[model samples]
Target: MQKNYEYDAVVVGSGPNGLACAIQLQRSGLSVLLIEGSEQIGGGMRSKEFFPGYLSDVCSAIHPMAAGSPFFSQLPLTDYGLEYINPPVLAAHPFDNGTSASLKSSLYETANGLGIDKGDYLDLMQPIVENWPKLAEDILGPFKIPKELIASLQFGLSAMKSAKWLSNRFKTEEAKALFAGMAAHSFLPLDQLSTAAVGLVLMANGHLKGWPLPKGGSQAIANALLSYFESLGGKVQMGWMVRSYGEIPPAKAVIFDTGPKQLIEIAGDHLPSIYKKKASEVSLRPRRI
Candidate 1:
């Protein structure tokens, strides 16, 4: 006889993704349980006092992606005490010449800092920024037919190029360095293929929605999300580490907010052999190292 399940869904890990998943599941009238391995509910979103009287975020510092996310925008997080603080400058890249190129919320202001390369910067970013809503939806997910085909094609063509190639379009060292810094976040070599893609998306995010930090710390975002989740009657269990599939309670579905290696380790025997092989091949660490 099949055993009865306790929850419709069980989300492992209480990170932003896990919390969001649990909230969505509960909103859809399913009984959801969110579990966290650590004592803290927030995974990377947790904040603590590193220095005396100074709070530091454990993982994520800047929240450009959160500000620009289509799903996050629809959530009533602000009502749950999530306030975002936008800085005057999104980011700054200082050169040896005692000058800095800053990514301002306004595209014109950011381009102005590029000096002679201002026009080129505007030309490269304007169209992408204008269609960021569609581009973000397409690029952030698995391969699919895009809703904005022309915009997606344009972004894909440009993004396929290396960061070095994209930087070459600019005339100033500051502009080049700015692009390089953004692209380097991909953890890939600047000359590697598709490195420009990360830079373009970050740049578009900066222009579309100014990169903002949650007031108090990144924890505020997590707290707000948790508050919202609980309000929807979702349940969370903390300090429960799921080591294997056998440890988890029977559920209709399970969502893991973990790396491929850990996922494979926990569920390898339960998964198809082909999928386990592919998961083992995937690496999150930088390949060039």
Candidate 2:
């Protein structure tokens, strides 16, 4: 007899990216199947009780970028029973000197808080703030030539320069702490240009859109997608990890959301020599370096 299970497309992983891809595919009328390695979904967005009711973010703490995101805005998470708590002051940068500075949803408030440096901060953030959708499209999606990638890089560099300058330009220690705190989000130390850029971009977004947390839990987002996928005649297999082509149901097209290393490891035999060589180079690159 023939096999009992199959799908038009199978997505490996149940992270936000994987679920998003699967949701789109399923909505397109494809017979989609989502396989997740972990028992629960949500990936980096998952929340855990770190100190009993503290509910620390397992990976990503804030949802500032998500709030500003056009992709997410269209998803209508509210309809899926997810409401966001938009904080007035999106983020507060507290210093040991009994002072703190913040980025708020109100641009005027953030500027007023900065005092004299307000103009300088606006100068650095205004363009990106105004063109946030384009900025996000460039960052979150696939790359293409003549894309906003170059413009985005330029924006980052400019923000870094401004942040570094403000570190010295500000008269109040509180102001400097604000800039430094935003920069620290890059996971880089305070002095680096890249780190400075990360901080400024985050602060800029907070001014444009307040940081928020999803109603219920991050898992709600995943559950909604999974529910939608089921509603659209798609099937999902939780706790099923695809280790190779043989492990997946037959499909016309496969969407692998796993990292490049995993893809190459599983599909190396079928890949072109040129592609395989490129993957090898990536594999050789030091993960931490």
Candidate 3:
């Protein structure tokens, strides 16, 4: 069969990870084609005006890991007219009793807000904060077992003991409520083991790097990246969907930013049966939902 299109690489979907991959491939002197099924680009990092001129982030309002995020932080977005702003307090959890506990990006300030459990909170977080660089690298990197994150992972295992463990650690209701509110961000049940790890990590980030949002909107970040990709000679095509291998251009590599199921549906015959079985169990990590 004769192929219809040609490129060194074709990246399906224009999400951050896809864009990043396309940008890097183009930078390395490869001809790259970025295809987006949606009419507009910036998949999940998209923004819209909810009220008149007031723009609201459609999804992922606060970017806690952007600065510590190895992939995003390395992109010189600012040079392309993209900027980020950090609110003084990272995030605040308001309790029913009219009291709120906020993350200040400062250990002492956060501990002071915790009052009675101040000392214990500091003791638990200091080591993590001290090793945040290593923590950031290991957690964000494409490493299954990065050496720097071993201690943090072990610490995380112990921290996974829920609000019940926290109640035993602190004698104050205020402290417990504060931690509880933070843990609820996990979407998992509060008592679930996953809640403990998520809440603790988020709180630690608050005391280390305050939650920041890109100024102008999330699209600005995407535009910056898109500009860079174009600068490196990458071509992006909007409103294009790869339905099968026939739809893909002749290329050495084809990467999909779409769902893994879509990948299987599009290329199942080319892939090993066992590979498709395993991929069926594995969710696409790049997707936000």
Candidate 4:
């Protein structure tokens, strides 16, 4: 006996990952139904009019990850009206004296601005920048044996150090402060181990691709993804909130683009007690406070 399903797959959430998942499923000849809780999709990529006509992004204003993403690079988003605007300076960190340390698209150009730390900066970043493609492929996703063993080893050694430790390598406050500021985006204390990795990756991306903003707004990226998904026959239902597993339409599979907390809430006892307990413990940890 064959079971009939209204959709081959049901994707919860309409964030970039969810949209991509639904799109890929539809492309693979599976009927996908993408449900979004909010009236509009895009989640963090959405933009709204702050004033009468001026539009501002709700979240994720600049996109270094988007520029360097291997998955996003393969998509024909430009055909769907998504345009990326790269600024001349990738990022700027101003000092009290009114001078600034800026990250530039060229490694040499960025190093040149570091004054006394020019050689140190180049020595620290040049190799990683040169081997970025292989390094990114190895580390950006799940753990796997690295194809570029030497490059991954070099990146791993530096990345594992605390940002404070890495800062000591630079003699100049301009270089140190710039690196610290970049690492702060990790939301961890500068002295924490592996925080340096976040800073280094951001700086590496800036040198490789120069952080870009989507033209019009960040929503353009989502809209383009949605347009592309629709072209592949993926159906999206806005304002469809799934409070429980029962709320989802009959589908062979369901994919969640949400955190562990939401997953436990929706699936409940359908998931193993041990699994749910772990998810709850992790979700209820002090970090949420």
- Local distance difference test, per candidate? 0.90, 0.71, 0.77, 0.89
> By the lDDT metric, which is better: model 1 or model 3?
1
* Alpha-carbon shift of residue 234 in model 2 (angstroms): 3.1
Q: At residue 72, what lDDT does model 2 achieve?
A: 62
Tens digits of lDDT, candidate 4, 12-49? 99998898889888888999999999998898899999
Task: Count steric clashes of candidate 2.
Answer: 2
Residue ranges of candidate 3 with Cα displaced over 4 Å? 1-6, 141-143, 159-168, 282-289
Which candidate, 3 or 4, would have the higher lDDT against the true structure?
A: 4
Give each model a TM-score.
0.95, 0.81, 0.85, 0.94
Error of 1 at 252 (Å): 0.5
Question: What TM-score should be assigned to candidate 2?
Answer: 0.81
Report the lDDT tens digits of candidate 3 across residue range 1-289.
7554468899999988889889888888889999988886788878888799989878766766665566667777788877778888877778788988777878888888888889887777777777766677666556477676577676566466765565467666766766777777776666655467666766766666667788888877778889888888899999987788888777988988877799998888899999889989885332331
Model 1 local distance difference test score? 0.90
Of the pair 2 and 3, which is ahead by TM-score? 3
- The C-alpha local distance difference test score for the whole of candidate 4 amounts to 0.89
Which pairs of residues have clashing backbones in candidate 2? 182-199, 183-199
Steric clash pairs (candidate 1): none
Q: Which stretches of candidate 2 lie above 4 Å from their native place?
A: 1-5, 49-56, 145-172, 189-197, 272-277, 280-289
